[model samples]
Target: MDIEIIAIGGYEEAGRNMTAVRCGRDIVIFDMGLRLDQTTLNEDADIVGMQVADLVKIKAIPDDSVLKANDGTVKAIVCSHGHIDHIGAIPMLAQRYNAPIIATPYTTELIRQQMAGDTKAGDAAKLMALKAGQRYTLSQNLILEFVRTQHSIIDAVTPVLHTPEGAIVYALDFKLDRTPVIGEPPDVARLRQIGKEGVLALIVECTNVGKKGRCPSERIARDLVRDTITTYEDDKNAIIVSTFSSHVSRIKTIAECAHEIGRKPVLLGRSMEKYATIAEQMKLVSFPETTSAFGNRRTIDRTLRRIMKGGKDQFLPIVTGHQGEPGSVLTRIATGDTPYQLMQGDKVIFSANIIPTPLNFGQRHLIEARMQLVGARVFEDLHVSGHAYREDHYEFIQFLQPEHVIPAHGGMTMTAEYILFAGEMGYTPHATAHLMKNGQRVKIR
Candidate 1:
């Protein structure tokens, strides 16, 4: 048996996740993602005209020179979710491969939207939608299986590649949330069945491995939102909440809570509208009929002016910029770029965590300081992570019991922590636990 795994990216850094697996002559690539820190900072003057060489210089997307060397050997490009860190680079890098890009319905929709935004990418991408749990044969020796998984985004999946060597599971950016607000729980039964059959290697994420316990469920976050909104319902000032736009479940919870408190739920931002519209079209989550989404600058300004004319307390606006992006709706609102003003005692809920990068820290500090100068009450860290924590990793390892494990989706320190945690589960380094770096290759015989 000959199976080789290549870490294209996402091993040395926290983002830009891409991995290539080769079993004999067939090669399959999983997750062409982006590094948000680089992509967000470098404002692409023309994404459509930007060449792959330019993107490589900025390191916004993975350097897929290794995969490109194989050319027509690639059978498929499979994506596990719709998160930018996992699917963002598809628009820029997917055209390099001759294989069809396969993903779940919602993820496929997002890729289509990204391609549509860029004319060059529009003609380059060839996407095929496959529902979770369905098996698609990529070649005579390879079958692709998607296991429905719980994550921050809608329609996230765990891809299991059934090769002649054995079964290889790619479990990245997921949590075992039993009580999710919208999607079904993690498909543990399918995972266990795969383990029973046999698993050659398990490439899992180590994003939250430093954390000790299981990550809290989305239900807890919904309850927190409910309590906070209830306590501030009688306030006369406007209420604004910001979170990850791709978090359809969290967005749905916030919308429902706002509706229950007798306030109109308004989504204001380009990304917020993009994801919400796709989820609605896919019938994943249903917002109230009264909920309104504003996508462009003109529409957002007009809607904010209307809200300002009426009592601000009558509307609950959910915008983007949880990471304090420069041009996002939250930053514009804080900087007085919008028509509406954040007055004294107005509520601003950050339903997300600071991503802990230097750029993010500085940007968030600026935004918070600006909001404080205007005397707005800020509530932060009211969100739960979508990645599995250390305990969840241990449980998943026990369930899979694979012959070998490769930790992905983190930096060296985070990946080290996962290695230590896996040691506690009786996996020895270099024997069963393989710690890989970007551009490194490992062979399983």
Candidate 2:
């Protein structure tokens, strides 16, 4: 049996995560995502109307030139989760191959929403919703199984491809959160069963391999939010919280805390509305009756006016722009571009971290400075990462025990850390632990 693995993206950086695994003539692609920073940088370039060639030129999407060589071999495009960095490029790239885009219900819904807004690519896209723990046979030689895994987003899965050679596990973008706020824990039993069945090779994410110990659970974040909010007892000041819009669990926790503190919760901004609507439609989480949500600018303006009139102190505004995007609601409110104003001692809780990019760091700094200038108190980093840290990586390696390992979903330094960690775990480089580069291919037999 011959298996060739190619890294189309997500090897050199954190975004645009696409990989192609070929077993003989049949190929399967995992994750068609975008480089969010690059996409944001080129937002003014009219990406929607630009040709595929021009989008590739600007690095907004993955360069699928290699796949063009083996055009009809693609059997499926599997998305691991609903994060933009993991599924955003589907509208731009999935139609290139005449294969169904398979993902969980939430992920499929997100892709459909993304496609609906893109006139250039939405008309031709095909989607198939596959729930976690279900199996789908793509061909006589290949079978796909999705193992439910915990992450920041809802319905995350780790796909295992059962081939004639053995089982190949794609374990990207997951964390072992035993105490998750919403979904079930990672399916450790299924992983152990696959390990016993003898995994041929395992491709895993290394986003937080450099950090020591297991990442904190989402429950801890909930407690932090509760404690922080309760500290302002009867303060009667505007309280705003910012986080990743895709983090439905965090949003639920924030809403719960807002209600507990005698304040109504309101979700604002386009992405916040999009993700929350998807979650609510799927019944993953439900907001309280007092909760209000808005997507469009005009509606947001009207809602803010109502919120201010009813007393901003009685409402908690949960918004997008955790990374401080220029046009996001948080930034607009901070820059005095909105009808609502920040008063002295008003609290802005950032329940997210800076993405460690220069653009994000600069934007966040500027927004914080502006908020401080307006005499608003800012609190940051009241959250934990959704990726597995070093100890969790060790636990995952022990659980899977694949013959070969490939580190993915991070930059050079992060992947190198995984390589060293694998070495320490007794896996030899090049022989067992494969260090791959973007667009490079490796053959395993």
Candidate 2 clash figure, as a count: 0
lDDT of 2 by residue, 165-267 (tens): 8888998899999999998999999999999888988999999999999999999999998889877656888999999888899999999889988899999
lDDT of 2 at 88: 71
RMSD of each: 1.8, 1.7
Off by over 4 Å in 1: 41-47, 68-72, 122-125
- In angstroms, how far off is 130's CA in candidate 1? 1.0
- Candidate 2: lDDT of 318? 95
User: Where does the lowest 10-residue lDDT sum fall in candidate 1?
Assistant: 39-48
lDDT of 2: 0.87
Compute each candidate's TM-score over C-alphas.
0.97, 0.97
Write the residue-wise lDDT of candidate 1 on 53-83 in tens digits: 8877787778888665643488999999988
